[model samples]
Target: MDLHFGDSEPTDEERAAVDALLGPPESAWEGADRSEEDLRWARGGRAARDRRELLLPGLHAINDRIGWISAGALGYLCRRLTVPPAEAYGVATFYAMFSVAPRPATVLHVCTDLACTAAGADALCAGIEARLGPGSGVGVERSPCLGLCERAPAALAIRAGDPVRTAVSAPATAQAAVLAASAPDSAPEEPPAQRAVPQAGDPSLILLRRVGVVDPASLDDYRAHGGYTALRRAFALGPAGVIREVSDSGLVGRGGAAFPTGRKWQATASQPDRPHHLVCNADESEPGTFKDRVIMEGDPYALVEAMTIAGYAIGAHRGLIYLRGEYPRALQRLEHAIAQARARGLLGDDVLGQGYAFDIEIRRGAGAYICGEETALFNSIEGYRGEPRSKPPFPVEKGLFGRPTVENNVETLVNVLPILTQGAEAYAAIGTEHSTGPKLFCVSGSVARPGVYEVPFGVTLGELLALAGVRPGLRAVLLGGAAGGFVRPDETDIPLTFEGTRRAGTTLGSGVVMAFDGTVPLPRLLLRIAEFFRDESCGQCVPCRVGTVRQQEALQRIVERTGAAAAADIALLREVGRALRDASICGLGQTAWNAVESAVDRLGAYE
Candidate 1:
């Protein structure tokens, strides 16, 4: 396919033709050849007036027809749906599944969003470049959303063969096919080992079985296996009961702050307003936190149920899922699930025929780490700079067009359905007093098995590390993400509870447990993190923006002047940490020092 750029504007007739071709009203069901039976089943009169409304089904049908959506086809869609060119462009850009550009012979989409970036995604990108060479047709694109934001730095490779067409006046002879088939069975069948029953404790086998990565075909399949039971139970008990049960369960936000989820809901519910909103914060950008991605990708219905339940609890008529653009697959899954829910009359007005109305719209973010912050996220949803605003008038007081909004992280919302379905006491009984229920810990780094794992909150770090298959003679554990702390080898014996982690001079921020064997040098690791902060700081605040660069230079000097006297830089590092922590305007700047401070205390010898 040839790519082109045109400078001249189209004439009035040309513009009208383009508009007529692209507008949804004009071509509602223009190309669709659905049978009367199919149309009846879908309750179709005409196709949807807003093609954007039909986006999920349209993309799915397109993918089903062709292995991938060609650029020309997408352009055709732009005209057929009557969708504004910009809006159509936005939709195509927002979804990872639709490639507006030409499909490369081989496309490697690497995850460079926050989580993957933290887990050495940059190094992996460099490695790919080194192996594949730069500017090669082997396309390596940094995808904003693969819906596996938590998996960070994950990638999907797609290979395309040149399109071949054979002009046929008549069908080919069966004799030619028989002769070709008789030539060879060169393609290998399943290996002998495949015949053997797979053993337990194999990481790959466990991931396939337990992770629930594949999409469920029907709501019945989902329901038969503990799907919307939570929603059913939630509706039966009513909204107040849900609020009370969640409160009693003592569930905290899994995003970062660990604030009480029920309390946030209550604050939003108390406000007697017209359009209170419930937002599921699926922008899981924290380094080392893939638990949210797992939930969104594996069991999206749980989130849908949870959000619907939250809407009921808060009298919210509309809900929004502010998903990061980096997670393309997650976004696609969510979009599909939302459409399915709407089709079943579970999402729109009079949900379950209960007279309560709640509809969800998925909004994509443009790769901003600050948008992970609740306030910053709110601004992004409103189409502004994704920078944090002051929090006295928290989102609960004024959010999303000056309405009360409850924004819970993806995992936190996922837990809500389970808590409401099961008794609060059941959840409360699982974890420590202050920290209740199971926490999904994302284990990464040098561990033999690195992935998201669920464990009771009170479990010890040593136990989690052992479960993660940490190597013997491990150096240190980086608990949480780049914003979290470094725990010494001895500190692994400490319990993994919230309070326990705090007592050990670290917050169990986002439950990211990264194990490091003794291979990588401590100074280099610190420098890498420092440099990351230096590059990522939004420059909104003086301390974080300027201080991170200063810290990087100081650490670089210490590394260069490595000797017994390099210990003097330790005090300077501590000072910088304290200043940045104290003077920063937002959480990004404020918490940026936590890792550095904890690392200095734990690994001063390296400095």
Candidate 2:
């Protein structure tokens, strides 16, 4: 029996979408069955040649335009790009977003990750699903963090007519939440994509000053509010001087590793190679990390300007923003920002008439959280399965297509603008000596005001909790996202800096602070954390794959009150976590046990 019984054929609209990418598959394709030009166009023609390395982008084009990747579309794309069908399918299926089966025109992705779960995402999901019913034109799928921790119980709706997904910030009210997508596309008065937050003003805040104040869609508005001031500064200093300033600022990667930014740029710039690359790690998939999404949706030009400066300093002509598939609003805003920048002679060739050419291309990830890793991100961008590579030929010396590439996350890159404009010394003066500059912390869960907060590096957890409206009777806090550790109520006095958290035997991982009140069940939360690791593990290394599974099983046994004592299960979990940390290839495996280990040992969740 054909399981795909009544799947619909690709609509004319869908075909038109793919045609835009492959450039009107010659008339010969209809008669020759795509055989005559298969090799020539796939490997030789302009359509396939330059874009073959952009396999991930090609898939994104199809999915975004058509709502799903069909079997026929995949085959046609494989022939056009010269990628084997098996390889293409593997890449597509590996991601959570790329649906092989047909889907409704509008798909509602409900957040079910830790942050959302705490905010009653499970109830929200169940309510929406019950209302919609199965086989409805509107479909619902539980998603990992959609990067809207601040607006807990959020969802992203992918509509046919819209260019990007519609982000539903607060969807817990009623079944009206599902109405977000059920409405016909034509009934709209203005395109949702054109909608922008009205700009307001607050000069007191540094990183977030422009967030709510600027009309994110207006390039003119951005310019009026002192935008591009950093780029002009960069051109004056030249690439070398800009690198020196950033290095002096003592800024580090905000993706939790704290690697020096200026050192990375200097290494990439000093590389004796041509055609280097600058990759903006916009694949912000950490469960509670939504600062990048807010920045992109609110102040996108900052990232564009930052990428341009990065390219100039690294001596690269091309820049790629590897955006997460889940962040449709960020992707749409960035797409507009890049286009606007190019039209204004800011992004494309000979930028600022300085004789240095640089451009940025946005590539949407399929749905692999592991792709958040630098190496895995590179592999995904190159159209391969998202997997991490062993280190020692770090990204600075060798990255993204065997050329020296400097990859930084959204927060890390945006910080560059302030560092260069404010002067490294001034910027460095604000934060702790080792952890310089302002940081964006994602504060969510059980708080009155759950959102992204900007603060200097050394702010204490107690202070942050107060700002976020911590509920009384607090039991503990999940200091980081799933990959981070937990902190007991007594630990609120601990500073929130990377070093401070480490000294307290936990990590300020990915700037995620998920607050938990006494009402929440800690054991269940730990089990979910374990389950996330098990599901997200790429299974590349045996330790991570098997260890994550074992860890989850042990946690499950404890949660179910299995014959095994809580102490025995906790001990078994630690043993497995240690193995994963010691033997795993990438951070996915190495840090898989952080949340579970912390909850059991520090928070006494097992008891």
Candidate 3:
């Protein structure tokens, strides 16, 4: 194993995280033969691809251990996974989260996008910099919205071997927190997060009923409060029966693309495959959305139980939860819940003594927004660049290591729990005929009590806003996320359902309702949205890569001028936006200009 990359060597911590993903690195003590043990560990083309699939995870492990990926570490990982050094390097440098050059041990990522900006993220970042001073040995930088609008002005603390957590976090403790991170043997731990328990004014309160009411880490507590009741019912009905029940429920994906979940499960099951993969799209990176985080953190078992049911229904032996890198709390809660389930015979070979083997592995995304797309997600898991693949041989036909995979968002999977427990017909009767089941609305920004509120599909945006304690003097509402459209205050009565949102020229995408009063400047807000799309394009396609940059530039000019120049820039913006929407490969580029275009044309941001 004569390996040559760079002069640098991975630290012990880096080596350990890499080894955890793809066994120990091969040692070549001067012209050593291909070791028998290494050969056996990585055997067959299938096994080789499997080993290669560990590339991203391996890289993540390396970065997780060390602050950045050094050339020596990347080369070691490439050799271990049998991947090309060039390809591995390309991957290492592709994501915003990964850094190639030497940097400080602690990288404090302060959120300065939309919701956070409104909540004083700019002031917080300046305060942190002021406290750290020059050559503080700590690195501080601004990050996009961390899907943490619920706790606005959030900052993530990334230290070697420590879970990424909100740093010097609270709006009040911003200055003190930064000083602590820089001080000697100091860095007072962030105060425990005071999780909000907003009681939905709507009496139904289904999706959020268990959120603040249950011990997320306790399996017995979940079971006592009707947890595995869904799984038990799933067992009673069998795979076909369970699929049928889902079909009857009219349940659709909550991560935008309201495709029916039951049809996808059926398609994956119908494929001639012995093992299928179930992926819970826990990568909730859509700006202004943190509902998935709440579900995973407060009601972790619901997700665990839901995933098992999905695996059983789709004939999958394994499940993968692609969690976001910023969600350390959710990750911890879900991991503990998984462990508890495995210990209780709820997840493992012969789950609940029903002879159905299903297990979950949590894979963290290294800050790639495009990986939220199904095909891109698969590619990321398979050790390739996190770029979206062409459709036709859709995910159901071939996904996840080139096998049939049924992918569902966190909210979509959790919906399965209630569907099975209460029966499909009963569940379908709750919401509108087209959009069924309860929904989690991540209400944040310019509101009195920003939090997650559950409502039935037909509930209006106005109702949701009022429930979230929106203050007077409402200006505009950015529905969905950065990728979702905008609606004026008058349209607050628009029903927050899939079809209703469509009729109103918007989407109930992941149920993100950001209320903006007249105070927050829309031009800068729209510019931030444009900048996010430009940075997260992945550069795999020409349209998105170039169009996003053009869009941002156009918004900049428009923001700079309000007369004829702004008018001309607005037209140019629309042209570039149309190109991105029509020519881009993935949903990211397609919807890149959604918020800005809606803000400009409908809400009159710049003009």
Candidate 4:
């Protein structure tokens, strides 16, 4: 944890790990052997300084090969990237996944978030911890959602080595978790991504039609399944024409904001700024939200194609997909899909021989939820702490290395495919007038068939739950994730539209629909939600950093009290929640109290 580089040196293994990503150092200034010429003149100016953006990737190069970061390895990475030791340490420590201290070679991440808890994650964690005793060469760390809510009580085992080994145990038993931790390579292969799509082969499905039916590993399979048709149409229409079609289709962002996609593209495209950039926000860290994960895993080609179209439309030659680090399967599938596309002339310079040069780079987020915000995501990609920047001049005006940038999440980008292929009028007609196009819902918790569902926007909450096979004794439902509001079971009549959810005092945040029964205590659930926000806060702003802690503390006190006994703490929660919502820098703090407030007002958790 020293702020300055020390005499300690990285081991041979550590040096090779870093070198693999950064290549050999050019001179003694970059951790190379000091030479006669190095003593006379100094190296390091704009070029060396510009490489600061490689700091995160260099840290990953170390952590991915070794179990945890060491002071020596951190110093070496900082030296190579021309970053200060203190700043590099700060960035490395900002994420939950990276460890700057020594630890076992294998670590087991047990999901303790809402859906997993509903499926008994606490007991599962206890059993796993008891099974993997100290000196067992395995460490167990409780994690937030891993985006595997459908098969709750999920555990991810990662073993550090030359090439890191990983395994997933979902709906996990203690024995399976321990085995995965001890020997990840020996664990059974994970189930196909399509297993998470209940209505995979249904003809009615739009976003999910190719999920269970196609061979995800084969790009040819994707092409045969009507993939790339949208991109070709985009090429024909040209940038302006493509934007017009999207505008006419009325497609909005699926990442809860519901911002008009065409308008965003138009703004970014029209920007006089040179070298505009495009970014795909694939970091789906919200608890109980896994629809993006399913799309990237099952239909990887769709996202690649969509990003290509988006980049072309915005006149951006480069795109980046900020993928979450926990999604090993999704990452693998997407990597393969991207390489295939690049090799086949679908990506890289002069894509599709259309004279439009564009390509994408995948940046893995090191377990920071705030990075899901567009500005924070930009900061993360730029190798800074994943903190949100103040808006306006907005992203379209100045973003991503101070250039105009267009950013959209996985689902929003994928929606572009349908909009371009099906014609604007037809696509707009699928859903209601305002909430146009089909939506993907991540349905889990107390449902017999929990999975990601693709349905038109106008469907009622009751209708969606019925399709998911809601279990008996349904007491409440969380319309969104932790940041979203809760609705009583009786409120299922509420329509699942953007306007409808807004009118009903709820949000279709990332299309999360988690059902809960009486067996699960609402008070305890609310406490966990509060804890997630508190832990995920970046501590950059006072309102969020302080308000989240106060919110959690008040909820902790009220969880066991009822009626008048809890009245004081409930009021405290409201006061603190209001401060957070009004003064917080980003959405994380702004909506941190939504689910808790809803639980108190609508579900009568205490009274």
Candidate with best TM-score: 4
Compared with the true structure, what per-residue lDDT tens digits does model 2 show for residues 171-218?
Answer: 344364577766534222321211221112436567877887788899
Greater-lDDT candidate between 1 and 2 = 2
lDDT of each: 0.66, 0.81, 0.82, 0.92
| 60-163 per-residue lDDT for model 3 (tens digits) | 77777777888877866765666777788877787778898988877788888889988877788888888788897788878887877877877777775544
Candidate 1 global CA lDDT score: 0.66
Q: For each candidate, give its TM-score against the true structure.
A: 0.74, 0.92, 0.93, 0.99
Q: In model 2, how large is the Cα lDDT of residue 398?
A: 86
Better of 1 and 3 by TM-score: 3
* Model 2 poorest 10 in a row by lDDT: 191-200
lDDT for position 554 in model 1? 81
| Candidate 4 positional error at 51, Å | 1.6
Off by over 4 Å in 3: 1-13, 26-49, 162-168, 179-195, 200-203
Tens digits of per-residue lDDT for model 1, 1-607? 3332223333333233333434422222343335665554543233333434444334333432343454445444543553444554554454344454555445555655443554566676676666666555566665432434323445654343222111110011222212212221221221221111112233433212223423433555556656777788888888888999999999999887989989999998998865888888887766666677666766677778889999999989888888765555577678888899899998998898888888998876645666788887776665344567876888888887778989898878878866876689988988899999878787776666666777788989988888767878777788878789988888888888889988988888888887766666677667767776776576767888888988888888887886665667766777888889888878888887787777777766463
What CA RMSD would you report for each candidate?
10.5, 3.9, 3.1, 1.2
